[model samples]
Target: MITPGQKIIQEWYKVKEWRQFPFQQEMEATYLAGYSGLLNAPTGSGKTFALFLPFLADFINKHPDYKTRKNNGLQMIWLTPLRALTNDIKKAMQEVCDDLQIPWKIATRTGDTSAAEKAALKKKLPEVLLTTPESLHLMLAQKEYPKIFQTLQVAVIDEWHELLGTKRGVQVELGLSRLKNLTPTLSKGEGANEQVVKDKVPRFYTTDALNWNANIDNAKQNRRQPTEAENVLWQFLRGKKIGYKFRRQHLVLRYIPDFICIEKKLIVEVDGGYHNDAEQQELDKYRENELIAQGYTIVRFTNNEVLTNPDNVLSKIKQILETKSNSLPEG
Candidate 1:
């Protein structure tokens, strides 16, 4: 019999044209089980892929007509906390969509998106709208723009841990609750609050995750009749859960980005606390010189600068994403 995990992989292999790991299986389980919880995992854990896979599978099964129009309209909204991460992630997501022959297009709409580009994006509404929390809030605030996001079946928030405790997080949770209210009866939490957070401010919980999982199961099929390939998937997943998993495979998959400058044709390195130490400072200086030697306009900011005045942070990042809206890579 195909284990539930194996069954998930079978589905992915057929639909996503991609392989599955334990993480992806769990994502399918949670999504299929009807749970809408933040996926708390390390970067490079294929977190975005995990969340997007189910949606992509559903999109192909549901909307096969996008191939004719190619790269158009508001289908999926991927929210990232930082504008700096937008281009690279968007490029990656779009490339995957291309490989799947899914004609969905993604655009970034943030404080960084130029006025002209933002206007054009609104006019076109790329199929996948990868944007920031602030930009999404802008879309939701418009009295006449509810339809812009009404078709959004799945909203994946990237770098969620950084957002879970902020005002932005509150906006997302409330927005999610609103979306659930419209689409399904999931997230039936009566906007519960303790004496302090009676206002239904942002938060997360293990119980919430469990309850949510129970619901994503609403749309998924039970793992009863998986094929032979699915049976192999089940055993593989069982081994994974038991800690007899892939040796060093996980470590090798980590992602390391070459820095980008959002201003002055520059790549900025806003330091975290780790770089404040003397040895770390020396190391950073060496790295900076190396980048500069390679014709990169590298700049650094104190961790304090990022923590205290992020207006300063936005000031630096605004330029890179302001690139022409038509500035897509050659296909």
Candidate 2:
């Protein structure tokens, strides 16, 4: 059986649409910050590739060393909120994996996926599994689903706005929050402090966790130590902290992250001219307080700030990351 790592390595450069992305550097940077959010661009804009490519690459390289048995749990999963788009996204990722000459496996299980295929996926887990929110809920309902998600390192939910104000969105929020509690890397409870995530952030960071040199492994005695910033991270961040991640952001069909940062357990939103009306502003404040009361450190970014001087926008984000890291103790 060809591994996903092998398939992607061979096909990485061959995907026709791969050459069209120029801003992908930014997208990939955000992905590495451990922030799970949207790509926020229109369809046919190569947004999906912007989000999935680096992730597939990273998954292939990392798994060879860390790959566990199917019983170890899913390493990554994609929840689209839309059942119809599941097949399209899965095919796109599979193509990228194939072109990279790496052995990569991805499967789609929506309401549309036949019982046979779903059963097969359960037996032989794929490197990347794409499905919808409801489908994910179905997976969660299974007797063995908890074990399945034991190794989950990332969950990319597409079209977040679709679910931002709806009941389905609530379900996903609850589900991901439960998963967050289970993840080894995050603080499971609502008690996490913001100051920690801000202070410990490393500068000139990675755009995509997937793009690290595959030859280097973190387990190496010397490898664990942070290297000189310029030597390792120059390719990803273009001076300062313009890093990124291949993140997916879809809302409407079933998601909308109007109020949450899944990784940091913080909720941040950017308000702009589109929402300057008194009613909207009041509503915004209300939501911010609601998230705050829920123990989230809600940060608001003005629209002009995000568009006019994005450096300020990025800096604010850097501070948030640092604050989050610092809040954790030196254990």
How accurate locally, in lDDT, is each candidate?
0.53, 0.53
Model 2: lDDT equals 0.53
Per-residue C-alpha lDDT of model 1 across residues 171-237, encoded as one tens digit per residue: 4554554454333223233221112332343233222443244333321222333323323333433
TM-score: model 1 vs. ground truth: 0.49
Listed per candidate, the RMSD to the true structure in angstroms reads 21.2, 18.4
Q: Give the Å shift of residue 201 in candidate 1.
A: 23
Q: In model 1, which regions exceed 4 Å deviation?
A: 1-19, 63-73, 181-331
Model 1, total clashes? 16
Q: How many angstroms is residue 33 displaced in model 1 relative to the true structure, after the best TM-score fit? A: 4.6
How many pairs collide in each candidate, listed in order?
16, 77
